[model samples]
Target chain A: MMQKSTIRVLLAGAAIATVLAGCGARDKAPAAQPQVAPSVAHSSGNAGSSAEPQAPQSKPQAPQPKTASVHTYFGDENGTGLVVKQTTITYASDSDKYGAALKALQHPGDSKAVSLFDGFTFKSVKLESGKLYLDLKLDDQARTGSEAEELTLQALQKTLFQFPEVAEIYVTVDGAKVDSLMGHMDLPYPIKRSQ
Target chain B: MKRLWVGAGLLLGMLALPQVAMAAGGATTQLFLNGKPLAAEVPPRIISGNTLVPVRIIAENLGAKVGWDDRTKQVTVTSGATKLVLTIDKPEVAVGDKTEQLEVAPTIVEGNTMLPVRFVAEKLGLKVTWDELTRSVFLYKKSSGTAAADSGANGGTSGAGGSAAAGAGAAGSTGANAGAGTAGGTAAGGASAGVAHAAEPDPDSKPGIVQAIDFTGDRLTIKTNGVTTKPNLFHLSGPERLVLDVPYAVLDEALKAKLNGTVGEIAVQHPLAQKIRFSNYSSDPPTARIIIDLKGRAELVPVEAKQLQPGQFAYDLKLAKYLVVIDAGHGGKDSGAISVTGKMEKTFNLAMATKVSELLRKEPLIEVQMTRSDDTFVELDDRVAFANTRNADLFLSIHGNKYTASSTGTETYYYRDESLDFAKTIHKHLVPATGFADRGVRQEPFRVVKGTTMPGILVEVGYLSNKNDEKKMFDEAFQNQVAASLVAGIKDYLNIQ
Candidate 1:
């Protein structure tokens, strides 16, 4: 019985080594990051930031999830400019911080600022190779004039650019690229931090 | 057992093929007018490669009165001075005093008088388009003047210009029936020619009809069948004459014949005018020109021109002043935005605009005209067009702002460089009197401000979402103060002491 148990342990060790070897080349590339599926079940306490390497925990614990303090921009009272507000968002085990920060934008808090996402909801928030892709579901009444569109887009860009991991932002509606967000201004395919 | 079942299914499928083919061959045709589905008591259908629709349905929708004579088996359609008579089973149609041939004539089907769709629609001065893919026929009023058969098209009223052109063109062809009455009549007939010709170019748009121009005493009344836009009046020094150009309007047959002689002079003797002459000014846009030879050194006063009714406008030569158009933003189906107190923004805008208009009306030499006096929706394009066409010196669009609940301020926007001073002058008086935060005068390409030729500005009185601002904007005393300040600002800008 002892000999049979030793053979099973060896077989398990070899399977892990083979799986690690298959992604060995990709692990060394500087530009390539772990492609996290949005449906992956993450652990609490320490999933680590996207900028750092994730360490596997030997013993999992039911500890408190980490929270991040993010800076979000909202429309000013007159809706002609953007105003910044600091927000602290709590994340679940499987939730992404990028998504949590975006969700906080819908609520303007006590700042008396107008929300740009009033008639919109987030469909997906994804980060790949320092590029953040955001898909939004628009309501039928989601219409803005030219002035409102300019100020709202500025608010969104200012909010997302605060994250160090996000180098560029790409916005789509219901998973498809459209000509304009509110039929007023053209949306660049990948909105960079400069804009 | 499985093989037996498969054989039975195959036999059943073979029997259904003929029924599907028959359905495709006899497709039920649909009819649409101005992009709305028009349900007919008898659905339109294709017969002998021509589409036929109920006569009363198409005629009455085009704003024509239809009468059926059982004795003569005839259908008569009358619009304004124009009349069309169609006999049952006769391929010839009588329009006014002229006769035109049709491929298919009026016929009685199921006790309803049916006529060729395109022929009757064109005779009634409506644009007709046929779509074979959906087996639909679309008819539009000429005033809408859009090529696309969609409801989003601009809804301009069908002015008397088109029917006047049709009537005049029909009468003009009576003496010379051998030749087609210009391209207007041929274009209407050509658009009606066959089936599956959806790709054909649209017929020429008929211009607004100018029925009569009567000048008596100091009042000159221009009568049209439909609402004619404001006329453009200018004075010429060389001939010492005053020229009045009516846009999108054409002279009727009787009037055209009356002014057929050399120089087309109408004998008139009045203190304001010595002689009156009329002519068809521009054919492409169908503008009618009426020139008045002024006596002495009297200048033609560019004032007292008002739209008396839907299709009538009168000019009083005794008055001269500046016209200011006040526009209230958003109403009716479009409530604009709901306020923090659940009040509609359109209501506040109308109240403020009306107050300002009332104050401006009391001012000497300052004429006030409002885009809307009550709760009704007007298109953005139409508002701009109204100001430009009326030759107004200034245009002001009043609106209530909406943002976050904390938003409270007053701001004004101007698009053109020339309107910056107007914006600044208005805001200077508005902000101090309202006692709200002065958001400053800014530049934005709002539709009303950008499209108007005259100096125009759009002012946001206060944020409707803010509780304090909403309460103040709805107050009668506050409205009176704001209205007085606005009039003072206008007087300052126009240099009216």
Candidate 2:
């Protein structure tokens, strides 16, 4: 029994080390000011899946471009530790879908739900083999610990995975693939969507 | 500004590396496999706070022949019942027919295939024993081992009453393990998940009383009503602390009253020490938990008291060497200040900071840890947290300054009054060594310095923005000179010649 407990702790430490190994800082960090809007810097050679038409509402009209709001998770103030919250994020166009999802993570629906990207910016985002890759540059204000690290990754993963097109999310801090998210949780590359 | 530095880049990995730092370190841990003491080729290092040993030593001792594949970077070990395949920097291990997700990956450190000891031991049906005081990992095969069963025995006694380690007539003291009357009165399930376990403690074991707490000389002792069982003791660095959990002891009326007047959410101080908090943290076999918030890195002395009084026994602890935290200013995403010669201030800060560590490490008495060892982004808050948790004796943040062309010299900064002496000591040697105009030492409310509890100094080696100062700061010879001078200043402050 004691050995099992000891193993759990070791696993936790290993989970954390993997994240720390992949975490990197930018050479030139900008100030802590939050970036304005998601830029058109988001690029995609293939955004073919999320282009399906929306089901007609009430009466048949021109096949309206499908739009959806992203759902994200954050630590809650009540009995349960985490609660999933929705934001006014819309993914209607294929070219701008990734940026919209990332924007939701950068600025959460609730102020209480922290923005993981508040002090960071992304150089680019890519999708291949059904996985979305994010190359981010973290700034000085970005907190590093079990809580901040895990919550930030969950917020990003849960939000981006909302799109049927994105089945897994692989995060690279400043362009390096990571083994864990923020040094504790196991970050299996192409982080799969969590229920 | 005098506080300028180049941005520290957080290095990503190849197999795309993410972050650089894993966890903190402590006194070296010794590894012992089976009944005989085993030695690791690389001496087993603490990575991210977990003690990892060379795979070959333990695998061979467990009767396994190991083979390493250079192309695949995989380690395959074949034992009697186990055939294991592990990859470097990957999180999964395949044991026989079962695939298990690994918490930590096996890595090649300095060309040695190092794997986490606990992971290896448990997978092979061996028990891993951790000795906190000596920092030892004792591995004993499960069939003949009694340690696991001994620890589990407490669970049987917890439900009936209080700590019954000795399992005698005093077992009727109202179960502290069942969320009943214990030390802090938070019920039995109040064992915090932070420093210790969250599971229920044994309630039926022979309950022992915590008669007294003794603090004298260089050691602190805990006195109990009977022979204390294997109470676990270990120290954690961040916010430096010590934890002692006596799983078979209950808070009797005498000790409960003392704890009642004390042991709250707010910690009470001991004159010689910081604070000692107590609780009846478990109920299974009944347990008593004590937490000590320390002021520095503490080393436990091997000598424990045989007897304090007629019925009381004592456990002794001691403190160790002075801890020093070194901070390299300006890292990734935050470019502190660009140099007049187009060099990044972050570059010089890291260079000099590492040099200082290289020189200081030669001294046996001083323990040095850098907030960063490479071009990685570490938050300013975390930098202080690293020092604060370690309860460092001194903190030195090294950086080259940036200012108008007219502003060209060395200066030192301090936030608290206690830090003034440190600033003056470093500046006295640094200015002359740099051959720049002396701006002297002054007080400033810098985040890194202001937040840390220990005396801290932020030294501006030279102006990165000034032409002459920039030229000097950029030179490798000058950088080494500055590093040596900083070490000298530290030695002087520590009263070393």
Candidate 3:
């Protein structure tokens, strides 16, 4: 009686082991097929247009992006200094209104400044470490002063400092430091924001 | 009584002979007196300024007859009884019963009443003689018997005798009128008559006397005895000019003393082909006739001096040469040009000009006129005008040039007109002597050039733009050279050498 019962139990154990193996194989096969097909579709599409191919290819690398930073100097209307947070400001390349006001202060009674800043527009504003950095692109109209210093100061300080994020503003004109516009004064150093 | 009558007859005969002698011998006497060679005739007689001739003689010779008048210095003459009555110094004559006024008066002298010889003689059909040299009176009466005899002798040639006699008489009258009438009339008339008439006297009068006037053409010549007197007084119109002419004149001490305050100076030159000229300058037409208070007699040869050329009637003032004015142009605010180094043109011009003036001042012959000694803008016109006002001899304007760094040289510019030669002469030496690049002389339209009456020119020194030129322009040694050259040129132009 004991020999017959032990043989039946061994058979039952063998059948259960077979069923679990089959189920595991099926799951593995479906998963492998789906992954392979999508990769193939991607490769074909890349082959059709090489220029857009890098977009998808780069997606995996998107999380590790590159950052560019530039430093500039600025002064106030009276060439004074001031401070504020970097987050509150917006910067522009050509902001003629701001430039005109600064030029007005420089010339004091010059009427030509009104027409000289007519079409100028501003481009971008940036801040790093509490200092406001203004990126400006001045049109021909905005370039005044014997050397355009007054116009640079006007646009940079007035426009950028309007934002609360801007604290101490700095400006760079065409990537250089010029002595003065039209020989009115010495613009040897960066102009400070007027308080 | 018989002896008395013989003596009276002798006396009467002497008087009658003298009259005949005067008619004949007086011809030669008048010839020498008239300042002309003997031409022909019966000389014209001037009685109380009226020319006259013997009525009976002229009329009878002219184939006319004489009639007696008992009233009013009258004598009647008739040709075929066409009678005319003439009186002394009267413009009236009676032609038969009708009275006619003559254009001029008849004249009487020394118991001889004379009438218009040509008029009365021709009217009376007589032949008259005119001695141009003697200016004496004569008549050739044509008798009927003489005419008949001449016709018989010469076969109807008697007509020739009559016409020839008339022509000869006319010729004689013309000659006579030129002499005695001319000389006697002018001498008696005096200077006042010539002035009143504004007419030229006849050319046949004595050398030292006034002559008969030619009312047709106004020309006058007066000769006076040797006596140094003031110029004869005369009046003129139209920018009224006064003229004075003297022969053998010398400025005496008294005259010189008077001239000091009254007359500016005297200039001398030959005014005419044979006349020496004297030009006098005074504030006005000499209020006091130029009283040539003389030590000796000076001859007066009054000539009507007229400019044959078109210009101011220059009175040649025979004066000693001494005075001269030198002028410099541009000053003050009119800083002509600014150098690259910021030196003002005006400053340098004035500085250099002043130096030149100082140099000239050292010379006794020169009188310098600085248009502006300081920094002040003088108008271009003012520069030359001032020189003219001062009667300057030479006007020189100093200027410096400014141009791009390329322009480098010294140039002198003059107004290309006749009046500015003195300026041009100075400029000739200016560029060469200063050791600057001689750009040569040029003609320009500048105010100083045009406005000056005197000779004027403008000098442009070395360029202020060129570094080399500027250095030379600023150098004192160069300036001295310029000044010296300018002075030398002035002296040379004036013939001071």
Candidate 4:
């Protein structure tokens, strides 16, 4: 039994040694073959260049994340409101889903006349609790209303309640609020989101 | 025979003595010339006991000397090299450079050479003074110095000499009417001839119009016709400007008075270039009123006047309002990082930034401005300079994160004390709204944030390389929530709750 166990152990050791030798050979083969096709390609493309072999392209580097907060909307017996805290949202690229959802909510008959929300696209959207948050893309064509007072409120209200996740929406155009646009309206408060 | 000769000689001597006395009386009357009497139909000439004054005497008193030629029957007066020659019994006189043909000629009265008083006085450019009490007339030469002094004293209203010319012309014609119609016709013709000569070039005209005048301070309120229009304020080097558009109307007294005290000079013009300029004289922002006369046009288009600073060779940007600077990071050559699906981190950063700007502009409490609105490379120093030039209120930079394709989160940073506090407040709500991992607020020396005087912060929304983070970033619902949270955070920090 002891002899048989020793033979089996030796066989196992031989197999391990073979695997180790294969790894070593695999590792050294690329380094030893200096006149290979890749080397020739490199030399031809970068003649007289003293650059080292390029590193692998697929390796991921650590990200420098900013410190910011998040908030969510919730409806209760007390009232419909928001709960704010520190959080972060993951990055993504598909912006059409929220646009499509917002388009579904617009009144069909009045949609043509109600140009305030036309071409409205959000860079990103998030919902905390019941409240929806949107990062809007402002442009000259985004202006609303015929008069100062009407335009300001219409712009504010139209942009706020376009999604189900949002019960209330707060807007910041370029990160600040003006006393009036064109010195005409007194926008005293943040525009609340309501259907 | 001897007795007869003696009697005749005595009679001749008596006749010669009376003639001498009459000549003396005529000369005296002309020298002491008189003006027209009050309420008199005609301007009276110098007359003594129905004996008309001699033209030679009057002319001499008015700085003109006279002489007589017996062969030609002409009398001449010479004063200061100017000679006046008149022929007796002929309606004509030659005075220095000008010649005048009189209506009534010299007549022999009591053996005296008596002529028209008005004719010679006017010809010599003398002023005749009248005494209502004595009915006496005085002739005096007009002194330019004395006339100038009188004009200055009377505030330049000494146009009496011109009126005297009219009076003389009228009297000459009236006096000739008493004689034969021939004299009347001659006087009328002479008066018309003198008028033609007097009608020369005038020396007075109006002043030029002043286009604009500016006072110190930023409050530009113009009142005109009791209605005020929105004032368009701007700054120029020569003068600063506040332009108020109104219907064409004149400035009222009160408005003029206010401008006089507030501005160095107030100019009124037709607003040809559709602009008015104001110059700052003090450190404080100037407050001024521009009265626009709207000519009853109720609808006036409002125009914003941008202030431009003078550059070395170009127009510089003038800060019309408090500036807010926004910075979008990792632009141009720096792509930052790529997501699992190959989405660039810089693109996400720019997108969020654009959204943030849109949200900020909706608020009217402050002016929303950006350092960059398009996807272009902006130098670090240039961004800082733009904010500094405008005296910005806040500088917020937007950026996105990238990690080992596994990490996912949101974070915010600030380099200064206030900015750090602001980051904490903003991150407090931003992280959870997007449902990404919270990286916690931090302090770092960011180039754009550190260089400005205003409170500034930088935001990193999520890790672009992380699959989950990328998915959330691509979600439209997430970005809107993130934008709303950021705005709320700012409002909270600004005490706008």
Candidate lDDT scores, in order, read 0.64, 0.57, 0.41, 0.42
Interface RMSD, every prediction, one decimal place: 5.4, 14.5, 18.6, 19.7
| Winner on DockQ (2 vs 4) | 2
Better of 2 and 3 by lDDT: 2
Candidate 4 is scored at a TM of 0.31
DockQ score for candidate 1: 0.09
Clashes of each: 5, 62, 76, 99
Candidate 2: TM-score? 0.36
Off by over 4 Å in 4: A1-195, B1-323
> What would the per-residue lDDT of candidate 1 be over residues B294-343, giving only the tens digit for each residue?
67434343334353656776765553467899998876644655677778
lDDT tens string, model 4, B1-497?
A: 00101111211222222111232322222123211111111123454332246443443334466665655768776665557787777777777777777767776432235666656665555554433333334443334344435433643423434543443444333222212111111111011111111110111212111223332232222322222122222111112222221211223444445443333233333322223222121110111223222221111222233332111011112223333566776556445455668776567767777777788778655466776676676655456656654546677777766434455677787777867777888889888887887877766555566655568877778776578888888777787778788777777776654
lDDT of 2: 0.57
Question: Would candidate 1 be rated incorrect, acceptable, medium or high by CAPRI criteria?
Answer: incorrect
lDDT by residue for model 1 (A1-195), tens: 676555444433332332334434112211211231111122223323322334544655544445444456677766887766555455664237778777777777544566777777888998888899999887633443346656767877766776666799899998887545653244766999886
Model 4, chain B only, scores a TM-score of: 0.39
Per-candidate TM-score against the hidden true structure: 0.42, 0.36, 0.30, 0.31
In model 2, where do residues sit more than 4 Å from their true spots?
A: A1-195, B1-195, B198-201, B207-298, B301-319
Give each prediction's DockQ, rounded to 2 decimals: 0.09, 0.02, 0.01, 0.01
Lowest lDDT sum, 10 consecutive residues, model 2 chain A, at A25-34
Best by DockQ: 1
- Model 3 iRMS (Å) reads 18.6
